[model samples]
Target: MSPQQKALILLEKQGNFKVGSRSIPTPGTGQLLVKVYSAALNPVDYKIQVDGIFVTHYPAVLGVDIAGIVEELGEGVENFREGDKVLAHGNFYMIDQGAFQQYTLAVATFTAKIPSSQSFDSAATVPLGVDTAVAGLYGKHLGAGITPPWAKIVNDHEPKKPIVILGGSSSVGSYTIQLARLSGFYPIITTASPSNEDLVKDYGATHFFDRHLSASQLMVAINKVTDSPIRIVYDAISLPETQSVGWGLLAQNGILVLTLPALVKEDEGKGRKAVHTIGSPHLPHNNQELFRSSWGMIEKWLLEGIIQPNNREILPNGLEGIIGGLERMRMEQVSGTKLVAHPQETK
Candidate 1:
């Protein structure tokens, strides 16, 4: 029999999560069999537990952000070998690719080496947040369709235009702020609670507004900061209320990128676009070429501090700690940080 590993399993659809044993999976072509040291929890994990979304397989392991050591490499893999630390965006469609396990398979194209200066917990936070941010900015069909900063012909020129992000303190929002800075969107504005103002600014927001501000108030305030039209609004919150606010702030021919489904009514022929982004690179719908292009740059960016990993809150009891962490996320208690679990410490 193959070596077995302990994993947190969702017993059934909209069902309980429990630690169970499963055979460790093997790496396939262009894949790495990773011994996942740290797995970060996202809101989607809790949603999958209760709402039964994303996963099609029962008794499924559900985690998307993975950071670990390469236990073994499959055929045709060259960049990494045994014992190299790496982080990857796990695929939701395959149980073998999930992160809520002691060992899982990672697609090499979407994986990046973790810098020696970073911890597994910190690296675990990078996958989903960075992917969502880059995809929203650079993805041709699913995103706002802006030119990628990683493009070969792209210049360091910063656009004088302004952008507004609706939830600057959230993970996706924080990354969006950084990427928007990289794309040279000047006067980068965002809305968050007054308490998280410093956190948002630390992530590269040029201007921060209280999230309680009305749409009209935000527009008025933004006008004083930059005379340029707000051509892009990334709504990382994407709740109905936030969506309405972001949609209202978009200019003609502007793009409104949403992390959640669109809630606001789209007016016909106005040239405004509302796009819901799926951050998973392994998904069939996303631009795999764009994902590969961005993942290639992550290591250098991490080492240079050009990209910042989200602040981390590590949970106790190893993999078991993930359950309560996900509960806190579901209850809306977590803010401006990623909840991470050490699966290798599981008893």
Candidate 2:
């Protein structure tokens, strides 16, 4: 018989998540089988359980941010060896690739070694959030088509340009603020609760505002900061009100990047665009190369403190703790922190 491992399984569409036993999967070519130590919870996991979105299979596993030690490598994989501590972006559509299991397969392209100074719990907070930020900012088809800082293009940054990010304290939002700073966008304006102003500023937000401000108030506040066109508005929250705020702040020829589907309609006369980003590296967009390029730099970035992981709160009870964590996330209780679980500690 094949090896077995503990997994958080979703029984069916819109089903409950339960800790269960499942056969451990083997790595295919160019993949690594990882012994998961830390699995970070995201809002999408709860959304999948309640809305039955993104995932189509029954009895499925759903987690995207994984951190652990590499146990085995498939044929043609050379960048990593067994026992190397790594973080990977797991795919929600692939049951065996999900992070909710003790043993899961990770594509080598999307995996990066974690710095020795970082714990597995902290490293687990990076993968999905950073990828979503990178995808929405640099992806030609999936985002605003901005030039990545790592790209060899002559004009890689817009030091004179201004950008706005809603939900600056979120995992995705925090990463976006960091990347925006790296991309040389000046006056990186972001909105969050007043309590999280320092946290977002630490992530490189140049200016901060209370998120409770009305759309008109935000427009007035932003106008006082910059006269330059607001070319990119990254709405990480993408709620109806937040979308309205973003849409209102966008300049002519600007693009509003949304993590969720856009609720705000675009005005063709103004030449503004609303882009819905797909963060999955496995997707067949023009973004595969971009993801690979960014993944290659992830280790160096983490080691050099160029990209900081989110503040993480480790959950109790190993795999069993994830259910409660997801509930808290669904109820909007978690903020400014990632919730990490240890699958290997499961009973």
The lDDT leader among the candidates is: 2
What are the Cα lDDT values of the candidates? Answer: 0.91, 0.93
Q: Model 1: how far is 3 from its true place, Å?
A: 0.9
**Cα lDDT tens digits for candidate 2, 158-199:** 247899999999999999999988888888999999999999
**Quick one: RMSD of model 2?**
1.4
Which residue pairs in candidate 1 collide?
Answer: none
Which residue window of length 10 is worst by lDDT in model 1?
A: 150-159
After superposition, the stretches of candidate 1 with alpha carbons farther than 4 Å from their true spots are: 152-159
Q: In order, how many clashes per candidate?
A: 0, 0
The weakest ten consecutive residues by lDDT in model 2 span 152-161
Predicted candidate 1 versus true structure: per-residue lDDT over 1-347, tens digit per residue: 98999999888999988998999998989999999999999999999888888788887888989999999999999999899999999976688998999999999999999999999989999999999999898889989888877774535574478889999999899999999888878889999999899999999999999999999998899989988888899999999989989988998888999988887776766689899998989877789999999999999989999888998899998889999999999999998888999999999
Q: What is the C-alpha RMSD of each candidate to the true structure, in Å?
A: 1.3, 1.4
